[model samples]
Target: MAIADQSGRTVFITGASAGVGRQTAIVLAAAGATVVLGCRDLAKGAAVRDHIRAVTPAARVSVVALDLASLESIREAAKQVCAEHDRIDVLINNAGVMRPPRSTTADGFELQFGTNHLGHFALTGLLLERLLPVAGSRVVTVASPAHRQGRIDFDDLQSERRYRRSAAYAQSKLANLLFTYELQRRLAVGGATTVALAAHPGGARTELNRNLPFLFRGASWGLARPITHPVEIGALSILYAAVDPGALGGEYYGPDGLFEFKGQPTRLESTPRSHDAATQRRLWEVSQQLTDVRYDALAKSR
Candidate 1:
């Protein structure tokens, strides 16, 4: 798919300090979009902004402080963003945490689930008003193949019973897909122009694995080397969902190679588990209650 020129568009991307999000921000900014980098570290985000500006002198880039683990931080960042931008053309829920030592967010939810799923959920809901009024606006979330291994154990959504790093990560990724599909349904029902979509990078060489145990990280890297692609390539699936005019709501994109590990981005299928309407609705309700940010505009038809 040919990427549409984003001239005059405003794009807000989380985790823009590094990896897929960083590359996505650069590409869109280079294409003439006013890109906002939502980073936990302002210094890192400013550095990325400077780097992009140095290369594309005409690029309009801004850095906003964002920490997905803390609802306070998320709300402040969203408020700052909405106060500054009248319309957001694309909001990429691209930030995520991989397998880390068991921990909790400020809200006491599991780290991976809170930061990766709830954080984006709240941010998207807060920013929906900005997106809904804009024609062709999109919410492109980054999920993963790890979702196939995930099962949302509502009995212990926070891993209070058992906390396996891989399981937590998988659950979070699955939640991403669920949120995308549910949000799309609500948007369509409300007759909104903003759409929701998802994408995955497959095996990308990024710092997301830095939190894994040393031996496991080294072994996995060695074994996965043949399947892993560069960060630029990883960002393609996300960019496709963000800019491709043909991409539609409730769609997913990933690599075209074997096992979807590498190569060009293309439309892909997710597990049937990710498509459960009942689970999606339940998760959405839980997310709203947890985040305290309501998608009232999209909820009228629900």
Candidate 2:
């Protein structure tokens, strides 16, 4: 059976130009949702939009330029989205950078931390008003298994003292889960019906591996069946998070296959560190400071 037709619903997805983000957009668009494709590259975004229209002639898809690395870009994108639509039923924080080399964002935060976590954090904060009035809305963040190996080094958040690509990526993924849970708690406290949840692609084959070492990349591809699944299968978890009526606030979904790498979407548990209340609160504060965005509606609801 197909997921229910999402006619009249609007979903905004970051990084929709490629990979699981792109696949998820296609699925929702085919189901009759108005899919807003958020991409750093507008040309690529347009191509994806055109492709969706071609496949699903009735699909409503729009391409918006979004660069998560820059707070200014995020603000501009949010403004445009809010102006174009009255309500956003779902916001998928799917754009992310994996184990890339040490790099800084336009705002000087580490690339993975800035793009993967802070970017979505700010975007959601900016769009909270549009979401709050809508009933049963959701914010679904995409995290990773790498979070299991992550440690939130509060003192060296930027990895200014010591930089390891994998460690920094893991930390950012962990931050994603922490953000999801913390946001859900705040939403509940504020009495808002806008729920927050998370999902992971679970080792799906996507262009996100462009940053991996050549040998490691080769190994991942060569061992594809044993390690990775197609992006479509991977995107199922995100679809579940976005549209599952039974899904609850603060819950997480990922693959149920071996090592949670490849299988149907299923409820999954995150690391103990991801569930730490103090860390989630602290990270929320730091993210606000770095992004200069605040969830003012949440405060008003309290």
Candidate 3:
């Protein structure tokens, strides 16, 4: 897929030190977009920025410190980004944790839910002012097919009652979809030019699985190796959603191959549960309250 020249566009991608995020950053930068990498480790992000500059000497790439596991870090990162950049053409909420052992964020929320969903939620809300004023700006979130098995256990959102790594991960991914759809609706109602969309890498061979147990990691690397694609391919869906002229708000993108495992990027349908407006609205309110970062500009439409 040929990407259009992104001269003058500015794209911010989280978790960009490695995996699909890193690939997306490099590709966009090469395409002439000013790419800002949001990485937990400043050193790793600087290395990636240096690498991009080395290969594509004209590529505009910079690094920002972002630790999604901590709300304070998220706030500081957003502030730093807003202070430096006047507008954001694209904000890719691509950073996330996979099926890690049960843990909690600094705010005490489940690790997967906090870092994957809530962290992006807060960041996006905080940066709405920057995005709202930009024409054709987009908030593209990265989700997973595991959302199919998810059920938002509102009763135990933090997984305090019980903890299953896979189940928790599924819920977080589902939240990602719900957030995307809801954000799109709000952006439209608020009459903002910014739009929200989502994409999934399908079975991409990324470091996201590093947190999984040894047996599962072995199965993923050995048994599931044939099904997964490289990070470059994995980032295609994200790129399509972020820059495709035909892509629309609220739309979902993923691989086109069998079970969406690997292939070209294409429009895809999310599960019906992901489209439930009621749940989406509920989740939005809850997220705002939990994160204490309100999208007042967007809420004006409500």
The per-prediction tally of clashing pairs is 0, 0, 0
lDDT of 1: 0.92
Model 3 over residues 1-302: C-alpha lDDT tens digits? Answer: 89999999999999999989999999999999999999999999999999999999999888999999899999999999999999999999999998888889999999999999999999999888888888999999999989999889899999999999999999999999999999998888878779999999988887787866664364255466787888889899999999999899999999998888888899999999999999999999899999999887676644
Instruction: Provide the TM-score for each candidate, comma-separated.
Output: 0.96, 0.97, 0.97
lDDT of each: 0.92, 0.92, 0.92
By summed lDDT, the worst window of 10 consecutive residues in model 3 runs over 214-223
Q: What is the lDDT of candidate 2?
A: 0.92
In angstroms, give how far residue 258 of model 1 lies from its true place. 1.7
Task: Point out where model 3 deviates above 4 Å.
Answer: 213-220, 300-302
- The digit string of per-residue lDDT tens for model 2 on 1-302 reads 15788999999999999999999999999999999999999999999999999999999999989999999999999999999999999999999998887899999999999999999999999988878888999999999999999999999999999999999999999999999999999999888999999999998888888777675464255545576788889999999999988778899999999899899899999988999999999999989888989888678767
| lDDT (Cα, tens digit) per residue for candidate 1, span 145-183 | 999999999999999989999999999999999999999
Worst 10 residues of 1 by lDDT: 214-223
Residue pair clashes in candidate 1: none
